[model samples]
Target: MLSTMRSGVRRHSALLLFILGAVLLTPLSQAQQLQTKFGCNMTRDEDGEKVIYGDTGEFKLDGERIEALRWESALYRPTHGFECSIDTSDDPQAEVEQDGDKSNWRITLKDPVAARHQRGYDFYNHGMNCSIRLQRDGDKLHVIPSCPALCGSRGNFTELSVDLKTGECSYK
Candidate 1:
């Protein structure tokens, strides 16, 4: 009878430990699911010109640290078609920082892109100082690119705002 009681106690203790472990881990699993994923493609008419823009990426978190991030953006217009396109998939220098509910991404190109000089007379290597900044708030992502090398004198990659849920975007 004593051996039976001891075996019952051991089984109960094991069950209790399993329940406690699951309860403690529930919040962590929920937090991990809060990671953000965003993708969008949009085009609109602005002053009789067709403007196209899009972006796709995901930001994953491990505990309080960003474990992985990949992002890409593109913009096109009739006036300056293919203004800017950036892919940070293989860029080891890409970095993201989070503050409160907002996140900021800074990306620099590893190779120079060819572009026409500001004079429009000669070709020059652009993207040497190319830098892109992306800011995310709620379901919106804002793209601010300072890549003169990617866009020559004939075109520019103006600031853009994108809606992650609806895939609607507009120049800002």
Candidate 2:
């Protein structure tokens, strides 16, 4: 009887440790995999009469047609740690083309880590000393800038929203 009781206790303790380890690591691992799934472009419609946003830059939505670009922006997945490259056929002359190689890149998220709008939103090392908020609207996601002027206009705080299905962003 004594031996059986000791073994049972040992098993229970091991199981508890395993559960705790998983619970603690789950969030960290999931956080690293979160990324923005959609990007939008700014466009000018009807020759400065109106504008429609696209993935790259400003253009006439009606008078001029611009191709829409889409890409999945995932967190820096440590598992692969694969490098990234840029294709600028859309705008080869754009300044963004300068960073054709992924040798040097940086991304930041706000502090106090507000809840993510989607299952894949992650809190990474952002070099800022203010709170961050993410807003979502349909298939668009907007990053609420932490600039003093922006916050001041928005009651001194970052606001966030999310599209349940598309993980799009929009500012409120």
Candidate 3:
């Protein structure tokens, strides 16, 4: 009877330790997935004109739900230049929806004219329909933007590829 009781106690202690370890490690694992940052900068000379463009952003999550995000893009050309930016730090119109490893961000501008003017693209009419999609695959983050009104003639935000490991970005 004594040996049997000792074995039972040992088993219970082992189970308790396992449970405590899992409880302690769970949050650390979740915290690792709670934040992500990506950006890229590239410049090239085409037709004797230097073109500079890139995207940079950071997003924070709370148990798979995006809590905040700030993304910006810029393009410079000889004839035209534009810059676009979105922030959810304090804007109620900014919404982010998560589906698996993909997220869709949409924002309704309260002052479309001011937004356009701030980005230095006042020529393009502000339609107040700004949308962006993001996908994460391993160490790569793909950014796809459909906000034509935010980006003028010389700016393109589609097919932006970011290397999360290296903080580099390029347009494919």
**Which lDDT values do the candidates have, in the order given?**
0.59, 0.31, 0.64
Report lDDT (Cα) of residue 6, candidate 2: 100
Model 3: lowest-lDDT 10 consecutive positions: 89-98
Regions more than 4 Å wrong, model 3: 1-34, 89-123, 152-158
Model 3 clashing residue pairs (backbone): 40-169
RMSD of 1: 7.9
For candidate 3, the per-residue lDDT at 152 reads: 54
Model 1 / residue 33 / CA error / Å? 11
Lowest-scoring 10 consecutive residues by lDDT in candidate 2? 94-103
Per-residue CA lDDT of model 3 for 1-172, tens digit only, reads 9999999999999999999999986755453343667777778897899998767777665543456777778887877776777666324254455555454444445565555566667665545455565655667666777665566543445458777788777786
Please report the TM-score between candidate 2 and the true structure. 0.30
Candidate 2's residue-wise lDDT over 7-87, tens digit each? 999999999999999998675443322233344433334434543322221111111121222221121222332111112
Give the per-residue lDDT of model 1 (tens digit) for 65-168.
44565545567777555434433333424556666567667656555332223224245444346666767777777777776655543244567677767767
**Residue 16 Cα positional deviation in candidate 3, in Å, after optimal superposition:** 16
For candidate 3, the lDDT comes to 0.64
TM-score each candidate: 0.48, 0.30, 0.57
